[model samples]
Target: MTTRAWVLHPDIQTNRDRKDPQPALEEAMALAHALPGLEVVGGEVVRLPKAHPGQLFGSGKLEELRQRLTDQEIGLVLIDGPVSPVQQRNLEKAWKTKLLDRTGLILEIFSDRARTREGVLQVEMAALSYQRTRLVRAWTHLERQRGGLGFVGGPGETQIEADRRAIDEQLTRLRRQLAKVVKTRELHRAARAKVPFPIIALVGYTNAGKSTLFNRLTGADVMAKDMLFATLDPTMRAVDLPSGRRVILSDTVGFISSLPTQLVAAFRATLEEVLAADLILHVRDISHDETEAQDADVRRILSDLGVDENTRVIEVWNKVDLLAEEEQLALIRQAERREDVVVVSALTGLGVEALLAEAEHTLDEVRMRKELILSFSSGKQRAWLYDQGVVEAEQQTDDGFVVTVNWTQGQARQFHEL
Candidate 1:
């Protein structure tokens, strides 16, 4: 309900830096003002030296903070950035209060925002995995094992240990259930492979208008909001390109500068949607001052997920309608050297067609070329290859038939033995 956030400030110069911690502090206050049960009463920051890590704050500072929290009645100390589990434990123990890192708070938010069945499952999975490591934070006393045949008989007997044991079992069960979901998803992906629709996934920081753009292009009424994690479950809908060629557009979980690692892995199912994508649309909020820093965080997360750096990515600088003449022109020139870039305002439908034109072109290079030869006897099988990709050339032979097929890595393998 209340937080005494301990922030660690570092002095580092970067071209694209996130908004100052001051705004987050202010934003935290605003949130408490809006939410009935929440109060971000006060906070403190320790500006550590470049190489200092032992204790975020020296003994004197911790004592001062202890006194400040006592005066403020702070119930929680939210570390506004990454902290080691050890440091987190130490900080909470020293401050004699509950602690939450930035990641934990974000996961809590996602857990609160998820609406659909899939969304809920993903959020729970993330929350459990995150909580799994922080078991030491438990405040209640442990209970003994309980069973139906136990010597202890009770009508309303409570079992804390039994509840946790049940949770462990449920955790395993949920993992298996998620695996099933993933496998079923893989099957759907395989079917999509047969259809050969180029997947164009829209990814950006939360509330960057990804869903709005998705609805404009696909005509689906997905819930779009001016809130964090408005869209939790990835929604993929068919969008007709400028050439009438259909490609799937997926609206995924929006990225945040300090997105939780637990949530990231749990949302791997959703993020894998990006990995499976034919082209990644790095949508940005050009209107926001933190746009570039958000982009860097997104890129860093993508790289962690093994997304190829050389993968075909289209940078979409959205909200250009909100930009001034000089700013728009400057961004245009900045994006000029990039192979694929567009300035579009999803809200106003400006430059949408131009972006679609680039989409069509980007889809063409989704798969690299691999030439394969098939004999005349495999005519029907060769026809199947054409379904997956273009057939650059074909030929006839006396012994049988030699057909050259241009296909993807998977299709070429399928064509080799055909």
Candidate 2:
């Protein structure tokens, strides 16, 4: 059964957040909808001079919201920001409804969407960490008496301490399991590194249409949806560029503003793909009202993930089909003035070819022209050059072949190794 929920974005007047409150509320509602069994019936931006540390609202406003929740029969209330454990318990008790803060709601969505074993384990670890923080006075049995003589004080572990210890032990086990999984992933990455194909990774805010673009470019049937966090596990496919050069394209989990710290730490392994990428496409929904903000958030997360400044990045202005014709034309013209930006519509296939052409050109810029002379005895190396399609021209000589090729430094190093 769907749980009826009300989403609220607290617009604290004294807060320094520059995001417009209405859009934040809408995003919160979208997050609620993203969860499989949540029915977000309503949402609103509640303005306050400041948040009360205990209940997060003034006494009168708290009572009013409590009455409203009761009258509307809302089973869950989602606050689109941080809520202390004490505040959460107090509000839940006063309103008689289950409460979920932004982090908790996002965790729930991730728990539902995670598919791969690694992703599932990461979500479990993050969820456990979040739950650990909420363990204060949350259960009725927290004070239950342990086995001991009535005349003497109880000697067994306190419930909260026991719960924390259990979580810690489980976390240790998960870390061990995660280490094995990460080792396997590292081996896979090493194998791919030997393939001599540059990796291009797609990154964007949630629902910005990265999967659609990935499917269109690679012809892979990855799930593409309008829902936030439609794809959680990292997916990769080999794509042949317009110039006949093949590259690996990776689609990663989308970023969101104020992403949970726990998730960021947990999903580091998955994001290593982006870190290793030869090029990154920062896709954006140009038609969205908060596109710039979303772009900033994505960039912030990328920096936090330790993506180097030297890594090549291209800005992909996506969802042009959602814009008016004139607006689309203007955007295209604007993009044309920039070297690192491409305007595209993944759904309509508009400018997709241009995108591919630009990607190929950008990648080619990193290659250096080199001439090599190989003897007939170097047949294996000669065949490898031909297989990679990097040899621009070859000429027969007295006892060898002179080969002219354009290749990246890594490819040159691999050739030397051969």
Which candidate comes out best when scored by lDDT? 2
Give the distance in Å from residue 126's predicted Cα in candidate 1 to where it truly belongs.
Answer: 2.5
lDDT minimum window of 10 residues, candidate 2: 138-147
Q: What lDDT score goes with residue 300 in model 1?
A: 88
Reference-based TM-score of each model: 0.76, 0.87
- Scanning candidate 1 in windows of ten residues, the lowest lDDT window is 6-15
- Model 1 lDDT tens row, 1-418: 3344433333222314434755555433332333224565555444543322554566777688778876777776666566666667777788887776677777767767677566688888887777666554333433432335545564333454445566688788888888888888878876786786777889887778899899888889988866566777889999888778888888998887667777777888768878767688988888887677778878888888887665678889898888888988887887787778898989899889989998888667655654445556776776676777666676666766455554433344334444
> What lDDT tens digits, residue by residue, belong to model 2 across residues 308-364?
776778999999999999999999999999998999999999989999998898887
Clashing pairs in 1: 376-401
What local lDDT score does residue 43 receive in model 1, on the 0 to 100 scale?
Answer: 50
* Cα lDDT for residue 10, candidate 2: 92
Candidate 2 wrong stretches, greater than 4 Å: 137-156, 368-418
